[model samples]
Target: MSGHAAFAVTVDLAVFTIRDGIFSVLLVERGTEPFAGSWALPGGFVEADEDAETAAWRELREETGVERFEGHLEQLRTYSAPDRDPRMRVVSVAHVAFAPDLPAPAPGSDAANARWWAVEDLLDGGPDAPPLAFDHATILADARERIRAKLEYTTLAREFVAEPFTLPELRRVYAAVWGSPPDLGNFRRKVLGTDGFVVPTDTHGVSASGGRPALLYRRGEATDIQPPMLRTAGEDD
Candidate 1:
C-alpha cells in the first residue's frame, strides 16, 4: 500500500419520503464550483472524526432541516469511478432512506437551496426536467431501484406508512413506489395469505368523508415476505 495517493471520503443521501400521497426525494442546489447552480443530492465531505453512516445523517440533518429522522437509512452502495468527481480523488458512500413525511427544507451549509422533487418527475429525464449534477443522477437511480427491489422481499413498504394503517392505504404505498397500481383484490389476498405479513390492531379507522370504517392493522414480526411480490409478468398474482 506504500506510494499510493491519499483520497477523500464523502457521503451522498437520497432521502425519499411520502408526502401528500406523492413519492418525493430531497435535493439541494449546488453552491460550489465543479457544477455550481445545478441540482443535486444532499451530501458533503466526511469529517475525519466521523464514520460514514454518522456523516450521512449529519449531512441530511444539516442540509434538509431534519433534526430527527424516523425511517430506514441503509447504505446503498459506494461509487468509486475514477472520473466520477472533479478537483480531486474522492469516493462517495451513497445512502438511501424512507420516511412517511418530512418537514419543509431550507438552504443550509453549502447548498443554495433544498427542496423535495417528485420521484416521477426526477425519473422522467428529458429536456424539461431538472438536471442532476455530477454522478448524482446515477446515484439517485440506483437508490430508487433498490427500494423497489426491497418491496418485493421485505416489509420495507410499511416504513412509508404510520401504524394502524388500512389495506387500501398500504396498497397506495406500493402503487406510488412502483409507479403503477396493483390489483386491489389480488393484493389483499396475497398480503393476508402471507404468514406474518400484518396483524390486525383490533380497531377500525373512520373515513373523514363519512364512509364505512376500514379495518386497521400494524406491521407483523416478519421481515422477509414469503412468495415475494415480483414485478415480472404473471408474478404479481
Candidate 2:
C-alpha cells in the first residue's frame, strides 16, 4: 500500500448582497502566486487553531472588512477535484453568505484588491472582466444554485431586505435572486397568504413617486415557506 502524502484543506466564501437593485458578489484579486492577479472568492487555508466555520468568517472579514454579516451563512459543499488547485493537493470547503448590506472593503492579507461586482458583469467574461482563480467559477455557480433552491422553501429571501421593508423591496429580492421578475400580484398574494411569513409593523414607506405609502413588514418566526415558491421551467440567470 502506498503511504498517504500531505493534503491541505482550505475555506472559501462566496459572499452575496444586493445594492441599488443589482445583485452583487464580493471578489478579490490574488496578490500571491498560484493565480496571481486573478479574481477569486475570498478565502484561505485553515489555520491550526480554527475550524472551518471560524476560518470562513475570519477570512471573509479580513478580505471584505465587513465584521458583522446580517444574513444567512452556511456551508455549501466541499470541492475535491484533483486539479482544482495548482499548488499541492488542496480540498476547499466553500461557504456561502447572503447579507443585506456591506461596507466598503479594504484589501488585506493576500488580496491585492477587493470589491463588489455585478453578477451579470462577472459572468459576461468581457476584456475588462477579471477571470476567476482556481475552481472558483464553479464554486460561485454552485453557491448561486444553492441560494435559488433555498429561496423556494426557506425564509432566506427576507435576509436580503432591511428590517422593516416594503413588499416591493422584498419582491425585488426574489427577482434579484432568481434573476427573473415574478408577477407582482401573484408574489404579493403568495407572501401575504403564507402563514408566519411576515408580519405588518403598522408603518409605511414613503412612495418615491409621491403616491400612497407602501405598507411595511418584517420577517416572522416561520423558517419554511409552505407551498414552496418553485421556479418555472427554463428559468435561469
Candidate 3:
C-alpha cells in the first residue's frame, strides 16, 4: 500500500422545489475557503462509516433544517475531476431530490446563508447569477433536465403537489418545470385517461378568485404514465 494516493469522497445535493410558480433549487453560500462566499449545492464530506445516500440525507437536514422530506430522492451522478475541488483531490456523488412547499432554510455551520434560487436564472449565466462553487452549475443543469424528462413519461410530477390537488394545480407543476403550460384540454385528457395516475377524491379545492370549486385528487398507486405525456418541441420554449 506504500505510495498509494488518497482522495476524499463527498456528497452534493440538488434539492428542488416549486416556489411561487418558479422552479427553484436550494443553495448555500460557502462560509469557508476553497470557495468562500460563493454559492454552492448543500453538501459535505461523507463520514467513514456511512454511504453516499446517507451522507446526502444527513447533509440535507444539517444544512437546510428540512427534517421531513416526503418526496423523490435518487443519485444523479458523480464528479471526480482532480481539480474540481481546489483544496484536495475529492470525488462528489451528487443527488437529486424533489418536494413540495419546503420550509425556508437556515444556513448550516459551513454556510453563511441559504435560500432557493430559480433554476433558470442560475443557469442563464446572466448578470444576476451567482457564480457557483465547484462544478455545481453543471450539476444543477443536469438535475433540471432530469426532472423535466421524468415528467414526460413518469408520474414524477406528483411529487411537487400535496394531496387532494386540482388539475390546474397539477398542470402548474408541469408548467413550472417545463417552462411552458401544457394545453389545458390535452393535459386534462391525458391525466384523467392515464389509469392510476391520479385518484379522484370526494373533496374539492377552493379557488382564490372565488370561482367554482375544482375537484381534488391524490397521487395514485401507479408510477408510470401509460401512453406517455410527451413534451413537444416548442413546449419547452
Highest lDDT scorer: 3
**Would you estimate the TM-scores of all the predictions?**
0.89, 0.88, 0.88
Residue-level lDDT of model 1, residues 54-173, one tens digit each, is 999899788777776777789999999888888788899999988776788988888889988888888876455587998998999999998888887788888767898998888899
lDDT per residue as tens, model 3, 174-207: 9999889888776887789888899999988887
Cα lDDT listed for each candidate = 0.85, 0.85, 0.88
Ranking by TM-score: 1, 2, 3
Residue 27's lDDT in candidate 1: 95
**95-195 in candidate 2: lDDT tens per residue?**
99887777777899888999988776777574676779998888988998888888878878887787898988888888887888667666766688888
Candidate 2 colliding pairs: none
Report the Cα lDDT for candidate 3. Answer: 0.88
Q: What is the Å distance of residue 125 in model 2 from its true position? A: 4.3
**Cα deviation of 196 in candidate 2 (Å)?**
1.7
